[model samples]
Target: MLYEGFESRESFDLLTVLKAFIRLLQKSPSSRIINVYGEMNEYDSDMKSWTKLFRDYSAKFELDKLMDQFYEEFTNTNIKISSAILGNDNNIQTIVEEADRIVHLAILPFNSSPKSKTMRILYGIVGEGMGRATRSKVTLEILLKEQHHVKVVVSNRAYKFLHDNFSKRFPSCDEASEGEAAIDIIKIEGLTMQYVNNVFDEKASVLHTMQRMPDMLNKNLDAYYKNLVSWMPQAVISDFDSFAYIFAKIHGLPILSIDNQHIVQRYVIPEEARESNPIAFYTYKCFVKAKLPRCNTIAVPPILRQSILDAKPLPVEHCEYFLVYQSSKSDTSLISVLQAFGEKCIIYELGREEKVDNLKFKDFSEHGFVDDLACAKGVFDNGGLSLMNEEVSLQRPFLSVPVENQYEQVLNAW
Candidate 1:
């Protein structure tokens, strides 16, 4: 939506940009440091006279009140300003040094540039499957492309995956700082479900949480506060992760819930996905509903990797093998069944180091996995929404054996 001082749909003035920033800060009311820059060489008079230069410029342009609001709004952001003009002082260099955000104004005047935005965001991912990490990889890359500072709070395999993928590009990603690539990660204990003989064990799951939740939460708090107090995030994005949801609630941050699990809670379940076990489904649904129950949540569609879009899935007649994925690594019965079929099969997440018969047990890699999926005749999976979305996109046929008692997967199957 275009606001005032936006000459058209795309362009905005410097005063307008400052006003917008102030308005955004006022609305969100979080810790931040912003450095509004202009054409560097334009103010070439005296290095120490920027205050006087902008004061004269402000008077000529009649931008006193808006500038005042801008200065007043960000006074608590840690840099003290004694000079009224341009809101600069002896410590003006500190603004550039410690800025959490930077805005570049067009030189010579206004309305010459677009007012685009980025944010300091705390991203939280649930640490169970590869789906959340893979989806987060795409979004995180997008965020880094737009120069948004992101600090991910995650644990388990998700942490390992992200750390390995991002370690090269952002070598100093251990802390959230203002730069070309600013990313930090805090390892926190994430939820894990219990499986008994390939079936979701609700009692064991509840018991696991009851036994581990307190220590996990304590460790999470200790890790987050100890490592990231200065990394004040303006927003939070939760991949159906309870830690992020709770952290947002505690810190009064706005949450963007990005996951397919929210479908049954926020939207409706398909009639085709009718519950096989009504009591189990109800219990699981209640748990999902309680995880991040709130009035205000930003919903987004399921995030898919670029490879999913690029894949051109071949037909069963022309393909050589079948692809199988099991979230439950304990499901050895599936291995026996696939073996009995006496066909070449590719398997994932069985933690196997070698091939068994014709079953090719491979380690997880995004490119390799997508390549296999593109050539595979069919898929056998546990009804993860991510893989299902990929299947739909690639037009691949699949058999879904959803985890028992988890309504989200059950709903995804249909």
Candidate 2:
């Protein structure tokens, strides 16, 4: 999956897309499955209990030996691991070129800032969704279920996660790997992090993040051409985070912009609802504008278009109260405004270790939102692509509170 994009996380979109794809696959009588990813953190809280239960009874093994045991189990199955490509080397031309056959999908995660007009325009072109690898994997699984032969090449980190969670899915892939021809891989070295410092640096500003992008496009293009070139990419199937769509376009590939469901949920609600509840509308709009643009543009099958439209309608029941979460960087004034309603208001502050004694308050840290949302009456949160999508997939009735200065796409998505 593309890890860092307009917004960094993609866990939410991954769950939703997977759920939809899995349901589709189950309906088919016969299917095969192949999966790929970057780094797979098996011990993450979401999968902790499943891993524990699998080990305690289904397959007795020690916690520390999980990786080895997991790999061994897959090796004993029909799945194949032609060769493990370990690092972010973009230079694997030899291996990629030598493949007698190839099925390619690109995955990336993105969230956008509403305050940035450039981002909004970019969304109109690229759209939003989950990472490229993930969408490809889901697509692959569906094809496999149709009894088609499938193979996958993924980052080392993501490979381990799949091995642990889906080792038994493809018993024959193991044999297929052995039959494949061997080839050398060219490695591109380094992991350098770059950031723009100015609030309005042409390239760094949210609007121009893609417009001002230089490296993705060739140097000789006209100004408009350069802007469009930023999102172009080369893979057969690409999952572009925010601006990466520019690269996908240049390379002549189909792009899927993956992100959370809330990005699309806000615009779906009725105008009456938005007017009657100004606070909710304002808050929700803020989130969408601030973050949703990152996933503004996405490529979807025609069959899925109606489903996307369906996401906007408000749930049948209206919640009595709304719970607003305060992240580490939250404004104190906002906290005070939320707590003014007392117990009738549910407020959570993330990051601070200390808990408040006030009856109307609750402390929800970075990790706490996961469990609390499981039983929440209703939720009000940033239009983060990862969390919001998971909430929708879980069938929760919720409202998105996107940050104001960014993410206009989220505001318009519903």
Candidate 3:
């Protein structure tokens, strides 16, 4: 769909689109579906080869045969579908002209913003974590500034974080007058991580997600389809969200993909680093590569907030505290570890919301965190790419203990 198979509730944006497309298909089985396969970015040499193979095969064989080959080589399950190859440039416009309705992925380009007199866009983002949401915020800001009518689908912590920020930044965007605003947010079901003894519990998390998935899927599908049919989008833009991707595939709509994960997929890993953990490294590389849709233009923009970019780093001598940022407040192990250092170093714990002991635990505020981080001696926390990047950008030492059983964090830490 947007990239590949649906993973979790984080991808509910994509799921909604897919459900809408299925409904359309059920109503009209004779619909002429023109699937357009997107090419991978130029930098991803390995994936580029696969793209070339698909392109060549599509050129040599019929649509059915090419789709069959695609399923055999790439996907685990067989999907009876046929597609045509369209060159990357202005693919969205082409799809809009041909298809009755369109759904596609969202990407924010610095040089050009989406402008249309006839196109209705549905933008999807994975909202389980803050990294995607943070990047989406910047993108949404640009879209709204350009006056693009975008319907945003998000869930879990991301929905609250985005809604709160948007409310403060654009007070006119309140539900009382959604039509007057350039953007509208729709809440959906999203996955929640499980933690045991302050570490991510993968098995428990998977079991919990599985248990709720059926109900979540049914409810979200119904809601998404109803919205999709009502809004009648002309295109879709996905940030590695599968529901949008699938919707585009089934309906033959133009889609664009944009995310930071592509940097990992495209960048050449050093031989030494690959050798260090060959299995993990390769697994992660393949996982990221497969997760994204094979789009013609895969834009990998730098993911950093303006605050992090503008804030000046403090001098090493003046830096005093060991700044701690935890996603969960329930994790006392991290608190205990930081507290052991006692008054030797001021332990500033930024978590959900609280105040305990010498550790100053509080809710996350962009300006407040940046101000504290500017004067921090070091950052102590789990391996989240956003914080790690900030610490490195500021030239501060980072001591990361990745959440257990979370391979993504483990890879980030490495």
Best by TM-score: 1
Tens digit of per-residue lDDT, candidate 2, span 1-414 = 332321334445544554455445445433224233222222323356445434432221121123233334332233222222222235555655423222321111111122322110122112222222233344444534443333222322333333342345654231222222111111111111122320112233444434323322212122112122221112322222323344345343454444333333434666655565466567656644553333335434322221222343334254344555532243445555555645344566543453343324554332244445554556666554444554565466666654443333244324
For candidate 1, lDDT tens digit of each residue in 1-414? 212233232333665665565555555423343223222122333435555444443342233333444555553343221111132224556556324223221111121112335466889999898888888989999988886768888888889899888866773332333445667666888778899888888789889987775456456654444333334467889888887777677557788878777566666655545446667566667877898786454566667788887777787689999999888886758878999998899998887768889889988877889999888889999988888878877878899998776666777786
Of candidates 3 and 1, the better by lDDT: 1
Write one digit per residue (lDDT tens) for candidate 3, span 322-387. 787665455656667666767333333333465456567656666787888888888876787777
Q: Give the winner by lDDT.
A: 1
Pull out the clashing pairs in model 1.
Answer: none
Q: Sorted on lDDT, highest at the top, how do the candidates line up?
A: 1, 3, 2
Model 3 local distance difference test score: 0.58
lDDT of 2: 0.35
Ordering by TM-score: 1, 3, 2
* Candidate 1 segments whose C-alpha is farther than 4 A from its true place: 1-118, 171-179, 271-275, 295-301
Cα lDDT, model 3, residue 381: 67
Please state the error at residue 126 of candidate 1 in Å: 0.4
Q: Count the backbone clashes (under 3 Å) in each candidate.
A: 0, 84, 15
Error of 1 at 83 (Å): 28
Question: Distance (Å) between predicted and true CA of 71, model 3?
Answer: 30
- State the weakest 10-residue window (summed lDDT) of model 3: 104-113
State the number of backbone clashes in model 2: 84
